[model samples]
Target: MKPRILYLATADARGHLMRAQLLAHALIERGAEVEVLTTSDEGATFLGEFGIAAEVLSRHYAVQFDERQNMQRGATDGNVARYLFDPRHMLRDIWRLRRRIAAVDLLVNDSFHPALLVMGCLPGWRRKIVHVYGASLRRALLDNFQGRLPNWLARGFAAAISSELRRARACLQHDFAYAAPARVAPRLFNLPTPIALAQLPQQVQGPRAAVYLNPHFRDPQLATGLEQGLAAMGLQALLVGEGYAGRAGWTPRDPQWIDAAAHSALIVSAPGMAALSVAQVYRRPILLLVTDQPEQRSNAARAADLGLVHEVVCWSGDARLFAIQVQEALQRLRAVAIEEGADAGSQRARQRLDAWVDCLLELAAEPR
Candidate 1:
């Protein structure tokens, strides 16, 4: 008999939901009976399209932002507790899922507090809580506030978030691979931003670029920059996800996104996990127009530095200069990708998932 698996993800963005879906599908393919849960109707619909119906619940996110649109660290401990990690939602979700969740043999959590709490109920069952942590809490915070905020203050916030992450058996660092070597989160393993690219075509020849935009950080200036690039090059752009100003691609549907990535010559997107994960797996050359989002900013810079991408374009001057940069970036894209760390790391993520599932099944079969 297959082990029962419950996968929970906080659908703050389509990216989180996509990761959860990918992991759940992997488990299902490995003969685990898997059920998925998310926090939003849109996320549920996304799963339904994949033929895996999902249950919805209350979720948490960062609620503190500064005047400069940066995530705040000064009052994060309290603000996160009150706003981001609201006990009321946790209580409600716990009550709603009280009966069903505890029956699962293993719980995979990607920001799903209720699943974590429920799976941690039995004496030794806490070890079955698999936490999927996106971005390194300590590393991203440090990078975001290097000279702007005092070291101690930033460290304090990291400590606070790190403490919150301790309620896991194994925590996989998604995308950025800079989790602390020891402690902080339990058994931190560096995993790629889980993308389901096993069956997709490796590459295709096309003239246009595929662009994905994050709606939260949507700026007219950035849109104009993309527009200028397209107009100058006369290359049709395929836009993905919620926000984009260029030619229409597909909605954030899985099939259309994959098709766009497979066919595009160059990929353009915010350095968010969703697009980057796909780009990493597809081994496509990319240009990132990073938002002020600290994690996105850090990921974009790190990816560019690692040679995983062609360039990071932060709009400083005007659209035309940005256009010139984009045109240059497109020209630099190699038909075949240059060898990069993200290339090897994405494969490692799949291997780790297989190992994790084997371990989970073994433990589940052991006599108590």
Candidate 2:
């Protein structure tokens, strides 16, 4: 019988869901039965689209931010206790998952707190695989270095993670780094693969541009200016992904936006892995908008350095200048034949994804 695998993920952003969906697809393709446990409705819907079963485990409340983009004081206080120690809720949810857990041969956790806790409770189940993405690992390391807790407390946390690491069958690091020679069974790169050229929609041809607006950033002036500028350039711009909900008159045009990207000449967006992966699969040149997040900045820089994209437009200040730079980037991309250059990057990305699938298959075959 094929191994039954349970995937645990926290859907703080679309990137998490996207990664889970991709990995689940890879697992299913290799004859494993996969079920995803996520923390958001959006994630559930995304998984459903791929025919993967998903159960929602938690809902994250938004934290308000100030003009400087920093979290406002007292904004998170209201939710802290519930987020940290809601045992009743956690236990109830775990009970729901208990039967499913008993049926699965292996568990694959992708940085979900409750799932991590559950894994710790499973004493003899040493076949758990933990997938650590770049952002969560960086956060853990930074928290340790910042002296955020007392020395004893810090050591305790470190010991807990170290013990978990030893128990994990394998650790899949999903970022652009050379695989470590030791300390893990199979080290795999975490990057999306390109869709097969023959499988891509034939009509998805031409020069197109994409823009991802995150409404939570609270920069209406910036968003308005960007939309107007893209329209002025007569470039076919596609906007996908959701911003904050409940904002006055803010409805996402995701369907139309997705269609636009598939047929556009160049794609422009914030450095979101999901968006970038889609653009790459469609063979579009991406113009990335840099953000405050370090991982995004790193992805943008690496993309530029690798010639996988056209340019990175940093929105530090001067909205007018930023708009001008975006326009110029679009013009440059429009002049090139994106299809001709897509081969190199697409092939490398596909190989990496294939290797990840192979690693997962090997783990599934191991004696339990």
Give RMSD to native, each candidate. 5.2, 4.8
Q: Model 2, poorest ten-residue lDDT window?
A: 193-202
lDDT of 2 by residue, 1-368 (tens): 98778887766555566567767887788788888888778667756765667888767433344432334435643553465557665665656666666787666766535445445446655455555555334444334423656878877767665656556666665544322222233433343322222223335344345565543355655555566557657864455435633444344434344445555666767665555655655567777766655456556666655456566766655667767877777677667775554445445555755776676667777775
What is the clash count for each candidate, in the order shown? 0, 7
**lDDT for residue 336 in candidate 2, whole number 0-100:** 70
Candidate 2: residue 272 Cα off by (Å) = 3.1
Clashing residue pairs in candidate 1, if any? none
Question: What is the TM-score (0 to 1) of candidate 2?
Answer: 0.74
Q: Candidate 1, residues 1-368: lDDT per residue as tens digits?
A: 77887788766556767667766777778788988888667678877877778987654433344322345566554544564356665555556665665687766777635335455543456666666656633366435445656998767765655554565565766663332222343356554455554433345444677776543434555566676776567677666654332424334454456556644666787677767666666567788775456677767767755557557777665767878887776666644555443435446556645654554455455543
